[model samples]
Target: MENQFSLAHLTVIDSPPPEMTYLAARAGYDFVSFRPIYMGLPGESNYNLAQNKQMFKDTKSAMKETGMKLLDIELAKIYDGVDPKSYEPAFEVAAELGARHVLSSIWTDDRNYGIERFAEICELAKPFGLTVDLEFVPIASVVDLAGAMDVLRTAKQENSGLMIDVHHFHRSGDKAEDLLNVPRDWFNYLHLCDAPVEIPSSKEEMTRILREERSYLGEGGIDVAGVVDRIPNVPYSIELPNIKKTQELGYEEFARRCLQTAKDYLNRQVKT
Candidate 1:
């Protein structure tokens, strides 16, 4: 089967889920990864679809009309003193929308605590048929491939796996060789994007670039082909978030370019 592409919400962060669904369809995406679970980050909107009944209905309507599937829902973070049960509502909403995965990350530096919380998250998402994918963020406590693998191993949950975001992997100084031995089942999907080869010196600089200005595939410094070749051939969720380009090109156009660049880049890989 051909690889499916998902229009990740971060690519069009300003658009609500309902509108994002339609936009994804128009932009030729097979699915969408939404941020229904609010994280309250700066410039981030709270899209609490769990409580917003009308918005939920609208989102469902859009999904039905566009035939767009909910690939996943994000930010089910494993943090200090966090209650995994608290995300039950978002899990319910994601299940209702037919999402197959739940995105999570480790925030606390305590390894045992991270494992416990991540396992709890997996258990909570189990009944909903959601697989929790642990992403390693550079600024977060789980800062590399080893840390992410450790959490999954200790969590020991069937419903848990790892999510490799190319940007984060590169930022963490992890190489494509590092992924070769990882179990294929651990990779449910990938966060596809590119960034400048130069590593930022400060965590704050990295955060700024990650949230506001990721490059399109092949346009930046990442050895995307090498990285992609190591992982499972699963859906690629386009998570390119460029604030300036979005402002200049508008959401629809920016989204189209995101998809196009991705397709072109992947095609080149095939030809080579």
Candidate 2:
């Protein structure tokens, strides 16, 4: 089950239902990521935490019917200056939902404090036996691969490491040499998404590009297959934010297409 592929919360964050498990299952996904219904990123629309308990309740119920477990709890929407004590509730949520990992990226002004913060978080998550997956996003303050590794190393937490998303992987300026640099065991989870050749100028533009122009792995400009071939095997999840495309097609169709393409690509790599 560690090799399981899953759907990211962003795919269906807007209209999460108790039946979301069914959608992921029918789409052939192995798990569903938690975006936490009410939490939003800075300057974005915010959903009050009042709805989190209900959404958590709904997600738990849905998993019972569909058998699609919650893969991870996303901390993407919660950025810097979060109350250190406030995360207690999130860990509690992850534990309740059978989530193994809590994922998030932090900003850089407090880079010196990241290791300490990570150590504290790891200790908190450790009591629940839940680990943390850190992703480096350009928009985030700690925006580089080196910065991420440094944080992990300084924190010295075995329970916390990186989750590589292809979009972030390439954009972070990781070279093939970068692939060789990553500690195999450190990449605990991964995401596969694609964008066309155009380089996005800003975070908002990047989101728009991914949402509008990205295609399934083999169809896009990203050397995803190459990257996958090089990295040590880990759980890879499809995280296309093609909301614009979904307006024309349904989730299941797009998911099936993406998964099949990914599976086919990986299968071929295996054969070779």
Candidate 3:
């Protein structure tokens, strides 16, 4: 089977979308995830391909030249006061770029409201052939796999599912066996990265750890092998972002190392 390993935009957020695509392709990634919407606060690197015609053209050209596909576009936060319909323009851009999924998360405590907004977003995305993958992170309102399932079930959207980011899965105190309870079809794709066995003392520390200090496959304390074994036949987004390492080695070298390390880890898992 072909391994669909995608390079997440967060791994190289410093590069523009077009440059990121080219770097990911050159580094042997099959697909690249783009962050058209910035999930963080203001002053973050948010690319508006819908408005920037030239950047959009360059991104499309890069993908065509490198034969790399657009795996997903991200950061669709479902929160109170945010109009889900406003994201239709972003969805349109994702559809035009041939992205198969849109990554999103819940930011509000109101489960009923969260479900309604998520469903609305799914409804908006469905016509474009995009699946809404709800990624549960520690800092988000839906903070675990179970919470993500709760939202997905309540939303009842045909084109919606859970996105298992392995780091968040482990850090959130979830077990590998928990995957057994999740419907196989509920999983659309996954993000892979390793982290220390020791949990961070606080949410801020954990957020900082995940955003800037994640380790490559097999280089940290996470049970990467066990997690890989549990989830079968799904595309993986290598979301490890180590700012220090990237600064030392540069994006190209860092991207190459991440791909090779992950490939080695997965290959060993298959043989075992």
* lDDT of the candidates, in the order given: 0.93, 0.70, 0.88
Each model's number of backbone clashes? Answer: 0, 1, 0
Q: How do the residues 165-242 of candidate 1 rate in per-residue lDDT, one tens digit apiece?
A: 999999999999999978899999999999999999998999989989999999999988888888878899999999
**Superior by lDDT: candidate 1 or candidate 2:** 1
- The top-ranked prediction according to lDDT is 1
TM-score of each: 0.98, 0.87, 0.97
- For candidate 2, report its TM-score: 0.87
In angstroms, the error of model 2 at 245 is 1.1
Top candidate, metric TM-score:
1
Task: Encode model 2's per-residue lDDT on 31-72: one tens digit a residue.
Answer: 877665345455333322334667667667888878888777
Error of 2 at 18 (Å): 2.6
* Number of residue pairs clashing in candidate 1, backbone atoms closer than 3 angstroms, sequence gap of 3 or more or interchain: 0
State how far residue 73 of model 1 sits from its true place (Å).
0.2
Worst 10 residues of 1 by lDDT: 263-272
Model 2 spans > 4 angstroms off? 1-3, 41-52, 76-80, 211-213, 269-272
User: The CA-based lDDT of model 1 is what?
Assistant: 0.93
Tens digits of per-residue lDDT for model 3 on 1-272? 67779999878878888999999988999999998865566556768787788989999999989988998998789888989887888899999999999998999999899989999999999999999999998888999988998888888899998898889988888898888888788877889888898989899999998999999998889887777777767899999999999999999899999999999888876434
Name the regions of candidate 1 deviating beyond 4 angstroms. 270-272
